[model samples]
Target: MNAASQSLSHSSLAYRPDVDGLRAVAIISVVLYHAFPFLLPGGFVGVDVFFVISGFLISSIIFKELEVGRFSFADFYRRRIRRIFPALILVLCVCYAIGWFTLMATDFKMLGKHLAGGMGFAQNIVLYREAGYFDTASELKPLLHLWSLGVEEQFYILFPVIAWGVWRWRGALLPVVLGLGVISFVAGVQKLPSNASAAFYVPQYRFWEILAGSLVAYWSVFHPVAVTRLRQCTALREALALLGFVLMGIALFVIHEARSFPGYWALLPVAGASLLIAAGAESRLNRVLLASRLMVWVGLISYPLYLWHWVVITYIRIIGADALTIVSGTVAIVLSVLLAFLTYRFVELPFRRARSSLPKTAILVSLGAMVAAVGMLSFIKSGLPFRPGLADKVKARETYAQYFENSLPEWAYFSRAGIFDAYRMECDFFDLESYRAGHKSEEPRARIDAGCYVPDTATKVMIWGDSHAQQFYYGLRQVLPDSVSILQVASSGCAANFPGRAQDGKAYCDRSNQFALEVIDKEQPAVLVIAQAYGHDSINSFVELARTARRAGVKRVIVVGPVPHYEPFLYQIVIRKHWNDTPRRIKDNLIQTFSELDERLERKYSDGAGGFEYLSAMRHFCNGEGCLIYLGDDRRTGLVTYDYGHLTPPASLDFAEQALGPRVMANLELQ
Candidate 1:
């Protein structure tokens, strides 16, 4: 150990306003990014910046405390509990209270599960297993930000022990720790492709970011000579500080969610934060740029600001407000600021102070009381905390029994293939482990009607793709004659490219594609009909798949567009239960968003080739301004989808009859 460095203690350390200023920059960028993603595509980098700042500040304090021989795990945990848990618990309480009044049973159920994850400090791992942050369906979960907190807590639990271990060993700990950080960074970079969620969420990959700050802390305390020598050149310090800010600004503007994140690209923000921290209070740029009184003030309340902004934006989106709109975004910020100020004044400051307004016993008791209150609220959400009648009323009643029994499969609703299940879904097709896990197929079933595959007499029409393609079965059965055959096979999560390595599970898709090619070569079927989900974003992949099919001797490939996925899942439940809000006459605002995807797709591939055709139900599904919801004469008997995207059996049948029947018959020359 460095004896001279051991002399420095927590008593000698002072709070750095400049660090708070850095925090202000991070929080504002994240808030702005979430509030208006287009304004700053890289605004999400703010979270990375905050992680670095957290590592630096916390490491500095820990180093100081350990040097003074006063470090205590109990004190550390108590401080953390006091600092983080109360406001989080408060937010959950208020959010659930709102859910009680406004949200439906299914949403409440989801919130309850997420609340449990949040309280347990494993939300990141939970969400990661569920498929990471950018999954379209994930935006609805309110506590998604808690994932970052989970990552931070994981760091907090492990880093102190490592630091203490190194201190006791009296060896080259700094170099050893830096080597560990380097290894983590390399591992993180390598793991980005297949397991992005793990790369994004797990501490192993993120440790380098935190350690970057820890390394700085080590330098400041044990290598003060370095800082002093660097500071002697004011111009160089100013230049480095300016470069740090610019780098952070570039990352916030240039980076995007579509790209893999927190990998090698993350070095920009970490290095930027490190530079600003290294320059410290002495650098003219940091003093003015980061430590400005306004910046310090915002930084002082940044934690609360971060907590409240997401909730505010989420509530706005839930109420059917445009999250990206200027007016709603402004309102969201105003509300977040107001709530943060209130929580900062009423909850954070008092709890953080050594001489709190409440007696220690009273404070601890209040925390217990608060926890009990939240527990009861959570139980209420689990199904009516104390009300037996309400519990029975809110339960998943038998009204949807027909939908469950005939309309939705247990596999459709709750299997790993189902929406609710999240296990064993991403295996490689050719891997023995994956084939055992069902990514591979044992055999290919012929998708022909009445076991007919006779030439000239029998023309088989095959359907291929994901669940979206699976949805076409109901529609196709209605249009095709009893004389001709129809074949359909789909698996969830498989893209058009069949895995050559893991061959078992993809047999369905491969056979369907192969069947179309064989029919073309054999000239048994008149038409080769194929359709898939195509959007502007998917145009390149869609074109490539279609080109491959065409080359395989398929006469034509069709592209189907995506359906609009709603935010709060209950909107459909309410519409189905009470009123008719069919896609034909959807709200104008929603139509605009739904149409955006279609318009972009149509523009890209409208003129591809004879190899491609666009089969659109847009005219039937939507009018010029909006789309229909259900397609029946009466409100009580219309057929649509049980959920937002998948079609109901009857509705799917009708859609097939209307859209693909003529094409299929013509393709087969069976009319």
Candidate 2:
């Protein structure tokens, strides 16, 4: 083996230990941050470290090959494909199989979509549409880490070609790389706050970090600066390198979820990695630090570890595993290491090494096999069965088509775009059919529904809650008699008891809660409906609000639990269409959780106070087997929610009629 030719051996350049140590820093930061966010809020900067390392390493290889006039994009891409595709394909296959057993149809369909995106190296875009990085459901996505891989892959695809073109023209590589870095960096900074999803997922914003590493490679090749001045202060050079690592570590610990990521603050890790790399091969301390056996092993396994850890954590989180204790995290770490080792040994190393030696026909056959397998599995999990007596698959396809044709109402489009004076609240309010129906005339402004149940006397029925409350508006209007009028002011994602909301420069939740209280006191509504999703925030806060309502002469307070989500509705719809699955069988296990919350609320209000009543849809929504999933089974329109969780206008209206309307009328007679 040529010493200089091997990536990590004593090839043309002696192996740099500090770079491996930098990898150690990067991986550790990511592991710690995900495992324990409170301990090191900024540990996510490790991704920045990895980006620099990758850019430097890949650029170095290409530049060295070009210098020797042996550069081949084909060879480079082949290596990348062998290295990336084998393990990735294995993971996706296993994830898909596991999903069939454990995941709901909605979840399975989502996984299939993600698998398709991962295959095409566009998982980042898929994730951006699904949810924010910090969203509650994010941890449940088994392939979430593929977003970074997608970014890196995108960089690799474009970078080498760009470098080759520039080198061919005899252009100054360093200046060009620097210019690109500056532009990308500016874009990243500008997009971080207002468009965090774009900043996080888009390659344009991430190009700078990669450029930073590329610039280092360009400098190392064309203008190698000897460290003559550092002879007298060799110790100081070691100190500086150590400081760089320490600064990265500190930044990892200090950054947090509330803070925007990969903005200017990301410079810390990138600069730290760059400085340590620049500290050179002769520094004894730096060499020893990076060349430590432990560091080298971790670095060696970093890629596979990065891949496996996310899959494990996602499954664990989806199942509501134990919190990240030291033991659990240690177990996770060990499992990650073991999985990475097995994958590298059996899957990655073998495929990568053997690909070149395999016959062309054999290689093509293998590639074809992988593609066929992916297509087959995607179809199967999407409800397409090819077994004996499988006419059901065809029937399933038919059923799904009939379901969509029947359940979707003409008014649903109006609901999504904001029409008919529908009040819109929440970030995903637009995700609703009502919001898409053109109900919103302005951003962040909600329209109050003109009272279909306008009161005769000045009676107020305040709709106070989160997205669940919004879902009930149509239901209430239909069920509620003309004696009680509802003033619907609901916010999405904001529970009635949410202490405050910081977005839109408004405390909408607090304002709504307080407004409900004030309305109760002023108008003395015979009935008050309090409905919201039963997760996050303290429900005890609502106890206080309930207390305040009773003290303010309110006659009745009703707490409504959230509706059961019937699978991830849209995802299932798409997958069913694509894979010949019946949407009717899509079930949401969360129905039990929703029902339980109502039971808990009923227990809380069982005392004969006569003012507090907990209303539940347990009897109406669910059968003994499970909840009614596909809203009247292909003949119902505007019944099932638009998204996985929020209710549609028709369903909401129906629910209001069933639960709140009659109770309000009975109470009003007493008043």
lDDT of 2 by residue, 1-671 (tens): 00011134324454666677667767777877777777778878888888888787778888888888888998777666655666677777777676655454434555766777776777887666554211325655687777888788888889888888888765667667898999999988987745566788888998888778887777676565544355237787777677777767667766676666788888888887776776665566467877687887777667777778877766655444224557766777778789878987897666545646555434633763664456446534552333234355544544443333211124334444342344334322223443334232112334233342234557767677666776666666667666556665566644665334323223444555555455566666666677776552244355666677777777777776556753334333333332534344333334455666666656666662435666666555655565544455442343455445656565565665666677666666777
Model 1 CA deviation exceeding 4 Å by range: 1-12, 132-136, 321-324, 354-458, 482-489, 498-543, 564-584, 589-597, 600-610, 633-639, 642-644
Taking all chains together, the TM-score of candidate 2 against the true structure is 0.66
Q: How many backbone clashes does candidate 2 have?
A: 35
**lDDT by residue (tens digit), candidate 1, 463-507:** 555456656655675677776565443344333443441122344
Against the reference, the lDDT scores of all candidates come to 0.61, 0.61
lDDT of 2 at 556: 73
Stretches of model 2 off by over 4 angstroms after superposition = 1-14, 35-40, 66-70, 132-136, 168-172, 226-236, 281-285, 319-329, 352-356, 359-480, 489-671
Cα lDDT over the full model 1? 0.61
Error of 2 at 341 (Å): 0.8
lDDT of 2: 0.61
